[model samples]
Target: MAAKLIEGDPQRLGDYRLAGRLGAGRRGVVYEAYDSGGRRVAVKVPHGDSELWRPLAGEVAAIRAAAPYCTARVIDADCAGARPYVVSEYVAGPSLRGAGRTLAGPDLLHLAAALATALTALHEAGIVHRDLTPDNVLLGPDGPRVVGFGPVSPTETTLTWPRLAMSAPAYTAPEAFTGREYGPAADVFAWGAVVFHAATGREAFEGSSLGTVMHRVLSVDPDLGPIPQPLRALVADALAKDPERRPTARDLLRDLVHADATVRLGAPCLAPDCLTHASPAACLPAACLAPSGGEAPRWAQEWTAERLTAEEVLGRRVCLADALLVARAPLTLDFLLAAGGAMAARLRTPCDDPGLGTVAEDAYVTLDPADRPFAPAMFLRLADGRGGPRGTRGTEERIAEAFGPLVVRAGDLARLADPALPYAWPRLAGWIEADRDARARLARDRLFWLALTTLLTLALVVALATRGGPV
Candidate 1:
């Protein structure tokens, strides 16, 4: 419906005039409209249904509630009436569901870090996104922009929502399905699922049908085969059966930042001393730790204060003292989670280790990038363009498409499809889209890409390496 505009439509909502369609969601059909002041924005109007007003208002509220963190900004809203509307600053880049599937290694790592940072901000604000998934996250050129919130539970009113399947089976936290009133950890579970899907281009839970998937998510163990090491433990912990076993968004974010900076990422620091300080973590054999004063951001102070407690998802300790003391501020890794899924194993850009790095988090691997300096630049580029991955494989959609049919129950989706499930493609599409910026970052430095390409030529994952459009 978003692709085709109704002809001769007035295209005017309040002070805004519709120009084109940006996208669609549960509450309304968002159009690329201009507000009264002539600013380009996304104007969301109701789909002739009154039930959407409250949720739309709630989404606006969530955005405002978390705006101080700037996790993602929702400029304004008009949800006061029976049929509500919204006006938000447009995110011109791709969605996580679009790019994440294609981004690998460090590029994905950086992006995930940014997202984790944002998640920290959200948790600190006393708000929890019950619906955290790839489609809801926009991969803007600048960084990750999280969208849609305020509504605690997805309601069933229509079936055309943007990411229906993402909610029912693939992206939602387990508690959401079991009727448990969950908190921030629920979002974290979804976060891991998002990372899982992006890393392998497959679902963490697989089944031949909807019933089978429900059994898989509830009774079966998630297939963590595609997850890399440093991130494996983190992702597994996030998906813990007991919500208490999971890390609070804030804790998860902190651990992610420190862990990412300390080790090469595939390696986890088991030493209590190394794990405690935010300083570059020291694992035996090789050193992946960033400088002592790496993670120092304004947000770092928030996490740095002793008033807040930090704990790993699995009771494994993660501290941030030496690193903070060294920098006298937040470390660089603190900003990583702002990139989304940085703490997860979804990204594998540094491919220096050859064999997908190593097996265990503490297990070490060797990286001999033909051109070491060029690697970081490649990651930054991929981060920028990794909004939507217009990848070469067309058959992959079958996997994504399978979700709508996979876990759907009769009344469950029919009632919640509007506010819950909604439409198809966009949700998963956003996370799976290739983050071109990440690739372009490498591409612009053609020499660097050339060097990395040479190295990738020997990699088994090379089969998974394919170019996407320049979206």
Candidate 2:
């Protein structure tokens, strides 16, 4: 909602002229502004050195990283001076919280699918929303867009509005309170809570106090009776207390869109690949069905140059459900299936990693193609408890012990394209063994050098005494 700017608001931020106050949160104020081209945009200005939210620099970096997805694009940021600000495309619409009525059927499906898309992009960029409440999702004419993405630096504590509470207890994940490390799974948990709220028009864990709400989030499963059919299972999977048990956003997108068919992949008649025919029946491989009586001559068989280059095929926007139709290998199909599979189907048995419990074992089965390249880095990231130069590390490691093989074969270039193995095994191995703390080894080397130097000096003195020199 727009409101006339009052005295305290800054007149302008960078090239954007602040015309009115769009809204204000604990950490900063969002102002409706006009850019240099007179285009409308929303400029966010953080309070001066305030403890209420993440540092403005952190927020700016996160926004930049998440710009490619359906998120509000970051136009510019001014962190050169004391009062840092970030400007992004202004989405003119009510937040999901103010959308008025509870969503059901197609409406509910679209909401879930859209949020899942946005969350997938954010996770791919290694950015966690941390706060994905109804208020953060803007229901615009274009579609539902996720806003308010920020970075969480190591050593930084939680931040919130001074007037408001510390954090939204009902939306926060269980591990966040238990002192256990969390990553993308935490956002997935919050996504489920938002879905519950959007469908029921009430908090999943409502309580008069923060403690009550947090306890419910940690220990209780939300009452799924209010959520409608089809969606009930999807939402239930997301709301699971075990983060590993929850499906990834990409998984939710495939399920929600396929459940109702309300959302299209991109456009009709625009298949991402030639193999992605109009329907499942059309997509059946020629080898799947054989001639019953006679065989047709090879030349007599119809042939056409309809097949396009793999690059061109992959360039189009295909529906999530149709991805398998065009996939060339079983691993690709396996990746899409596991990516969109149900949470219950994904979880096998519980493992040790706090970020990914049983999901790790499941990863070994289907093989997380995207995660396979980063297993070594993920191992180090979890061990160090910090994100490094390779962007933020997510908890997608299949197994911590798997790093030994990777570290041992770090320099074997011939193993890279050995389709028998994963694509990036050597790099993964190198990153793991290379990132371990070297202080102990350096200390040992220094002690040995000191002892050698001392022995050499004593020998020189003894020789001088034996020779009856100037000493």
Candidate 3:
């Protein structure tokens, strides 16, 4: 809803003319504006002067980088002017918070798919919508368009005058309360919460106060009875308190759109080129090779593109090691499943370097338990055949020479396991260790050189004094 311009509001900002007030938040007032070409736009003006415009300026790059899919496109910005503001395409519809109707069936499915697609685009652009509440989602004629991408203010409130406060607290992931930096997984959690609200007309986690709401998010399991099958399972996975356990937005999109039509690949045989062979049994395990006209094992039928938990993969009795061996180049979903399985089993890959085990374990200690599952896939994806400046290198060499330093520089395990990227688990632990040792050795060498130089300089000074002046 747009409100008439009140007294003291600016009539114009740069090329855009302010028409009315769209909304107000801790950041500043958002205005319904029109560009010189008469195109409708939303202008966000910060509360403070130029010093406070940094975040708004940074947001332009982030929004621009994101694919224009289910999101408002950034039109222009004037961060250097007396009154800095950002102008984006004005979405012509009510926010999800203000849409006074419950979503079900096709409507609920559309909302879920759109939101997931928006998140997948954002994550691919290396942007995390730290604040993904109902109010941030505008239901336009095209679809649900996600807006309000910027730094999250601690004092920001969900309450907006006349509009009812929805499930803002419930949308926040558990890790946010524990002081961990928000990641793509957190957005997925919010997606689940938003979808839950759309389907059931209530917040998954509810309480009388902010503290109570946070407590529930951290500990209590939300009642998923209202949500329908497949979706209920997906929502439950998204709402997992452990961030690592949460399905990525990409994973959600794939599941929502292709739940029934997913392609199922039977377990691959031991041969390296089994996938390329003519016979279906070429890729199938010896036991899985059905007798004349007989159906394959129930376990082989279960291997679909659908997202499965580590426990589910193991329960199917599939061999993760065999899966990894036969996985085609440029890793596929099958590889990701095997990686997750490897993480759950704590399967140690054979490494000649005896110290590698200790190093990997040390690096693993730095990660939260939730982050451990993706390390192995992360390692394989990063180290697979790719190598040094001159040529390709071995796995151990790539780990020490290339992958290790990258992990140390990132300083966050979450980045390695990002849902949009390929998955990994244990190998990253080892890489982190190797990287640290290399850095430590370099530091020691520098220190020794400095000590030697200091001693030589002192001896020269003593020799000069003993020679008593001159020649």
Candidate 4:
């Protein structure tokens, strides 16, 4: 069999059954796997007997270690094996290089903003992604994630650095050619070059070959034609002839994200590229499929240029089904699913809900085993309280008090039916802004509930099997 075919084959790696291949390059191939826990995980098995797999130990470690720094989160890693592999959050989307010429105006601006945020996070971690080209940056549902780290620098550099790492003609800073220990500053320079390409469909650095591009990058001024005012200054700063003159990634991102108190803490609202997916755990990263009020392509066009943004497809809809169905992460729907029959004797108004607006107990519904909370239960008590003879019924208020912490407060309830709830949600997020820690506590409580439900289900099966009476 051809080497590519052999490496790319979908098969078992240990006990995990591989579904299919995702992507592969010099490092190794990644396959979809179902773990013992039955969670959908992307498993990367390293190439055996290759020098590339050696340094990959550090690469894998650094990736998991710096998970918070970028959108490409590492869920697990096995570098101790002869062939090191890393399992991470599978963010599905196109690389910036492949994003095509379709993006312009706001879509383009949002992409820049996401890139700036990711770059800022990476720099803060003190790890410089030596290869910051468009091909290495992916547009995930939540935001941009930097990838392709063959030339990633460690806390200290040694011999394995490639010639390409020495300097890219377009993105190479002045000091890079002269051999200075590159740092976050190098990445800043690359961002300018990458953004230039993103803004206008042109490689900022055009040269006859590798040699020409390098010479010109060192000598020429960057072409900033028709660059909008918002990012023009940032691009110029990154492309500064003097490395010291450039601003840090965070500083640059702050300016680009329009860092108001509201915009910074909440999810960024720039471009579709900033949106990885409506459900961060399931599906690949992207704007919604059809985008709000947009058209979807016929099945045939998927082969060509009809890839819809997640927002375009979902049209501002957020579905928790995929992530909830699988034990993906914190967002599982098992608890929400249990809410249908969840009978909270006291309903533990336990510190989880943030939407309380002097409402009673019935207003907030308990979460199901899948951890999904229903809006109807969250607001029913509001109506009950208003119609009652007093502020709230005595029993309802007490139930509300017990579950007060757990109940989704009425003030927190907005029209769950709102089309824009996923895309343009209110400033007071359902997750944040609560006086109590309902979201977290509910997640914890729901695990117990799901276990109980599973036990109940198994017990019922056992009773049926052992029954003496014939039907």
Clashes of each: 80, 4, 13, 62
* Candidate 2 lDDT (Cα, 0 to 1): 0.59
Model 1 vs. true fold: TM: 0.55
Candidate 1's C-alpha runs over 4 A off are 7-10, 46-62, 67-70, 150-167, 263-471
lDDT of 2 by residue, 252-314 (tens): 765554453313332233223333443332444354334655653231232112333223333
Quote the positional error of residue 325 for candidate 4 in Å. 40
Q: List the candidate 2 regions with Cα displacement exceeding 4 Å.
A: 48-62, 152-165, 257-471
Candidates' lDDT values, in order? 0.50, 0.59, 0.62, 0.50
What ranking emerges by lDDT with the best candidate at the front?
3, 2, 1, 4
**TM-score preference between candidates 1 and 2, better one:** 2
How many clashes in candidate 3?
13
Compared with the true structure, what per-residue lDDT tens digits does model 4 show for residues 352-374? Answer: 21211212223333423232232
| TM-scores for all predictions | 0.55, 0.57, 0.53, 0.48
Candidate order by TM-score, highest to lowest? Answer: 2, 1, 3, 4
Measured with C-alpha atoms, the lDDT of residue 125 in candidate 3 is 79
